[model samples]
Target: MSVTALYTDLSGYYDLMCADIDYREQSNYVRRLHELFGNQGKNVLDLACGTGPHLRHFIDFGYTASGVDINQPMLDIAQLRCPEAQFTQQDMSDLNMDAQMDLISCFLYSIHYNQSIATLTDCIASVHRALKPGGLFCFNAVDKSTIDNRAGIKRQLTHDQSNFSFQSNWYYSGEGEQQQLQLSIERTTNGITEHWRDQHAMVALTFAHLQQLLEPYFEVHILAHDYERIAPWENAAGNAFFVAIKH
Candidate 1:
């Protein structure tokens, strides 16, 4: 399926597919980061804001939230989930906005969706343009060099009389600036089973390279990927939370 069709088709199941994610902890943790590193303004934006799960929490935390996504179907559901917040269908790499924000976030490693280093550079520039001075741009990412091709995650759930099995992994070829997110889902209802799979293209770079990309636009900090605690990222770790302040 085409990219548009792929997201539209999975929009309904996206939340279910991420049932194991602790969105509240993630949101609250970011809120804490904002309190520490942000401009203290209430206006905020979420990039690739699928289903607005984090937006809902941000709104409840007293933020005036807005979101952007490439998929209209996801935005439609997000509108229902966050009626008071604004949303637009736009490519994040080409992000444009009339309103500046104090805090901008892209969570769940969704920053990888930019597809290429050139576009990822565009995204960083766009984000800098969208933020107020002293504003924060926070997100999580993984170093391509540390990706373990043999490791993956699997989980199962039952909903609406259907059993769903979800599996996902990150794969890198031990070479250039490209990676893939391989995902598959299995649904079984009434003894009939259906399977679906997709491989998403993602840009690959080392943490040092990623830091170099953000340095021109922001004051960059690489933190350990623990949402519950604020700590520096040790050089050996694979994944990290990046907090950048607009320069």
Candidate 2:
């Protein structure tokens, strides 16, 4: 899909498409990260914080939380959903927060949205700049399993609300970088059919690559399996979450 169509399509069903995410579980993950720091600090900056679902947890935990996202509509919904917290419309790489943060989170494979390696490197460097000395930075990336195990040539999921249904047919390029998806969505009440053909490019980096990129700036632990701590190679199966403390 063209960039314009990509933005329009996502804006139309952003909430409906992401309704299945377990926000409580995700928030717990963030809270656990903070708990690891003990008495170190109390402020957080959530980058690419879509819908601000995770920010609520930090606020409830008594930490001052602020969120930033590139999409305006998403930021609007986040602002409304989290009126108590600060939400700004901005690109992650371009952020310039006057205050340093104790924690920074970019979750849910949002880092891969950067289309190029240079941009990805810049994002990491920017995170390093935004964090305080010894502050924690955490983010997740798509495991190659997501590419290898990808199937479901054609699928239809009917959300009880007929107007909010999800349907897609997908197949990936052998390299796993390119994905071809044909999406057909319908709003039963309005009888509006929104059709889109999307080609998304992704880069799946390994633990080794990420380690090399972050070591200079951080003391890192790779959480290959569970959320709380990094396990040995035995459990380093599919997904991995990297937690790095700025040095």
Estimate every model's Cα lDDT from 0 to 1.
Answer: 0.92, 0.68
Model 1, poorest ten-residue lDDT window?
1-10
Please give the RMSD to the true structure for each candidate, in Å.
1.3, 3.5
> After TM-score superposition, what is the CA distance of residue 14 in candidate 1 from its true location, in Å?
0.9
Off by over 4 Å in 2: 1-12, 37-39, 144-146, 152-161, 167-186, 190-192, 225-236
Query: What digit string (tens of lDDT, one per residue) describes model 1 on residues 1-247?
Result: 2123336886788898888899999999999999998887999899999899999999999999999998899999999999999999999999889889999999989899998899999999999999999999999999999999999999899999999988889989999998988888888999999988878888899999999999999999999999889999999999999999998
Per-residue lDDT over 104-140 for candidate 2, one digit per residue giving the tens place of the 0 to 100 score: 9888767766645566677788889989898988877
Q: Could you tell me the TM-score of candidate 1? A: 0.97
Which structure among the candidates has the greatest lDDT? 1
